[model samples]
Target: MSTYGSRGDVEPMAALAVTLQELGVEAVVCAPPEDEFRALLERAGVEMVAAGMAVKELIAEAKANPHITLPERARKVTSRQYEAVLEVAQKADVIIGSGLMPAAAGARTVADQLGLPFHLVAFQPVTMPSPYQPPVAYPGRPLPPDVTDNRELWKHDAESMNVIFGAAVNDHRVSVGLPPVPSIRAYVLNKRPWLAVDPVLSPWRPSDLLDVLQTGAWILPDTRPLPAELEAFLEADQEPVYVGFGSMAMGNAPAEVARAAVEAARKQGRRLVMAKGWAGLEAIDEADDCFVVGDVNQQKLFPRVAAVVHHGGAGTTTAAARAGTPQVIVPQVVDQPHFARRVAELGIGVAHEGSVPTSESLAEALNRALGMTRRAQEMAGQIKTDGTLVAARELGVA
Candidate 1:
């Protein structure tokens, strides 16, 4: 198994590895060395072969060079990352991967070489060829509804991805002695596709390929006890509002988000637990009602929070929902806005316009979430936390 990206991506891959291991399937997770959950995977008894690239550094590069096109981004992934995946693939029976660029592309080549089946798991719904949803694009916005089977749009989307990453993928193929591919559509075709989400939060897209499977939400198995100070703070009064933008670089968004978080807490009369994620929130420093922290298990903290304010990554969204907390998502990219919409549609939360939001807007969102606490709790109760096991069973690994 291999994947790339932030905690949101790695954690689910690790969870799946754990499930596979429990089912007697030996699994090793491969990804760029900087994954936050490398330790989590190792601690959970899943072996990790570090892909040499630093995922955070790669993301920083991508963010810094916004002019970089998708194909360039795809081709730009360090050869070391692909090498690590190839090395690990040599010993595997089935190649399972997550993420679009390196993982799926690399796994496709490896699987073809070894005559092994390649399976994909992802938080993004459009990763598969979907007949129900419009092709995915950057930033959050509505798209024209699918009037019929979305295969053509899906093909267009796949070709666009090929344009972005195909050059680099072909280069790797050359190094691995595999023939270059003309299109990337093969990566999504006739493959085992798993959408790692909870249906209650993200309903199945009707346009998804008939073969696509739902793996449910994959959260870290460990929920470490909160620090004593955090424990005491939670007991202090009404639950605090949680403000975090997981894996998104701050790049000047921190101060704005911090002010909004503080102001929202003040307006709503709640304490704040602000996670200083990739976005290092500066205004969080001087706020008396706010407690700033680095990454901690949201699975443990969410149950105590009054509401969740986030960038709407899949892992965080599921964790918040299962904790029975209402979420206020200010989405920034693919699949995030989709999750935000589902939160609102389910009557459990609200979604902001985009990533940039003001204190007034945040306060309103928090207030809206606060009003639906009971509904959020009900949604939480209905979520199947055992999705990982279900996925393993479906794979027939056990």
Candidate 2:
């Protein structure tokens, strides 16, 4: 298994790895060489092979080098994957690729070279092209305003993918003595790519473009106990609103976002449990009602919260749903908006209009979310928790 991105990307792969191990299959994961990722796989008792630069380093480099185009950066990252994943994949019976397209492209090429069966896995349904939904627009490339048809949008999406990764991928493929692929999108997605998402949360519509395997969201059972401080805080409060943007940079003003969340919770007459994630969000003041936590067990904490205010990552959204907690989804980028829309469609949460939210916006969303508590609880029982098990069985490793 190979993946690259934030905790959201790495965590699910780790979960699947753990399940595979239990089924008597020795699993090794190739991912970004970040301390947190290493620790996660270590805890799961799975071997980890560092795939490329750490996610932070990659993001920082992209920011620092403004002259470098997205395509060029993607080329560099994909090239690095060849160096890292090739050796590990040589010993594997099959190759599974996930995370960013460029990284997956590199791993796929290695699989091609080794004559291994390669499978691409998407965490959300939006990543896969379909007539039911349009593809996500590229960073600087927006879809034409006049184009309302999903098929046209997907066609443009394919063109954009080719523009960004076609040369980068084909160049490496040529270097490794493989034939150049005509469509980078098709090559990466393959004929039957797996969708690792909870069907209740994000359903995959059958498409003529590809045969998608919809597995329930890969969830590792988190046994780590919540910190005593957080436990006491939860005990003392009347179901405080839990606010956290897992792995999202939270834009240029993380502190402002944190303050807005705190103020919003206060307006609702509720306590706040803030997670200081990768953006390093901090409390504005040492208020007793606002408790700040770091790297705590969200699985154990979400059930006790009034509502979850989050960035709408696939994993976090699923966790909140499984906990039977209502949500306010303030999406950031990529598949986040899709998850936000799903939450609202399910009547389990409110999707904030934009990425950045002021106190008023957050409070309003929070109010709506709190009102949907009954619906959220009703949906909780429907979410499947056996995604990893199902995926392992599908692999026929046991």
Candidate 3:
């Protein structure tokens, strides 16, 4: 019930929590403090527990000094929540860990303590059908298994396969005050110890886990319809390209990013719609062809766009995919590159090199995405059909 991270990390859980509430299931979402985030959840009619750290501080530090920032502190808080859960795990029938951070890991500890079943959840496939040394407990469905063994699963090369993540289970045991066990392989979910979580929301094989969970996109209360300015922006223009860096992108020089996007759009003769994210782009004056608006729902927004340019967060990737819009990702760091690779591999989009992407490079990628052939369009359609509700159903919470 407790989770912590940036708004992107916490928002999805908030969405899921709200969806659970609509089904008469009450769930509390926890995260580092951010008033905007609390507002989002509050509008969804979901209860949020703030961890008292300013999310803006975390964003600033992540860009300035990623090695020491909120994620580490968030981990500490999440790990600490286990003491609270330990007291209640016995009364709870099921515990689910949505991410691999302290909260999810802590959930696993308390689950085992109370002998409750737990499932690991993943929003991406990188952690699944794992590539590193295979977890003996759960030998995953090897990627292109015909081409390699379980060891060769993660590393596209054999030499890399020889290297392993080492005995992380022991580390987890130590972190949670549990006895060191054997070099236990992956957890029950992915079968790779390093990729373990409480309950994985695996959609490829609905019955792969105990229950299939659905993706609960954030549900903002029905407010006044898009303001006239935004409505005119969406209606007057041809589907513009969407340029947004969700919760993670706030740390970036967003105005610069938005300006770069403007230059790219001008080159392509397309409009640019920027998501009102943590990235500080709100001050950019809106022109007839360009708009800076707050919180246009991604599920509703991406489809109207010709292409999406983003930082390659998994949730954003999914949103663009659902819209059947090809994506052009400019990955800054972290799991972004991984998601970027998946986009290229799946023909869903292209990944740019970094934060300093040139307008020409971005424009070219946008053209490539906008020019998706009929077959590619069909493929995108297939992906879109993996609806949020389907994700919920798979999780057994629908």
Encode model 1's per-residue lDDT on 125-190: one tens digit a residue.
655566666667433222336534467666566666666667788887888788887776555444
Model 1 TM-score, all chains together:
0.91
Best by TM-score: 2
Error of 2 at 106 (Å): 0.7
The predictions' CA RMSDs to the true structure, in order, are 2.9, 1.0, 6.8
**For residues 310-334, what per-residue lDDT tens digits would candidate 2 score against the true structure?**
9999999999999999999999998
List residue ranges in candidate 3 displaced over 4 A.
Answer: 22-24, 51-55, 59-75, 83-91, 132-177, 180-224, 250-253, 282-288, 373-377, 384-398
Tell me how candidate 2 scores on lDDT: 0.91
Cα-based TM-score, every candidate: 0.91, 0.98, 0.71
Task: Give candidate 2's total backbone clashes.
Answer: 0
Q: What TM-score would candidate 3 get against the native?
A: 0.71
Kindly list the per-residue Cα lDDT of model 3 for residues 1-398, writing each as its tens digit: 54556655666666566666766666665555678777777777776665435657755556677565343544454455565556545556666555434455556666776777765555544434433333222122224646546444433322222212113333555776677543222332423112211121123333222233334333222344556777677888577888888765534466677777888887889988877676656535646667877666677677678888888776677667766778888886556777677677777788786666667777787778777634345555454332334435545667
Q: What is the Å distance of residue 94 in model 1 from its true position?
A: 1.3
Question: Candidate 3, after superposition: displacement of residue 333 in Å?
Answer: 3.1
| Model 1 poorest ten-residue lDDT run | 138-147
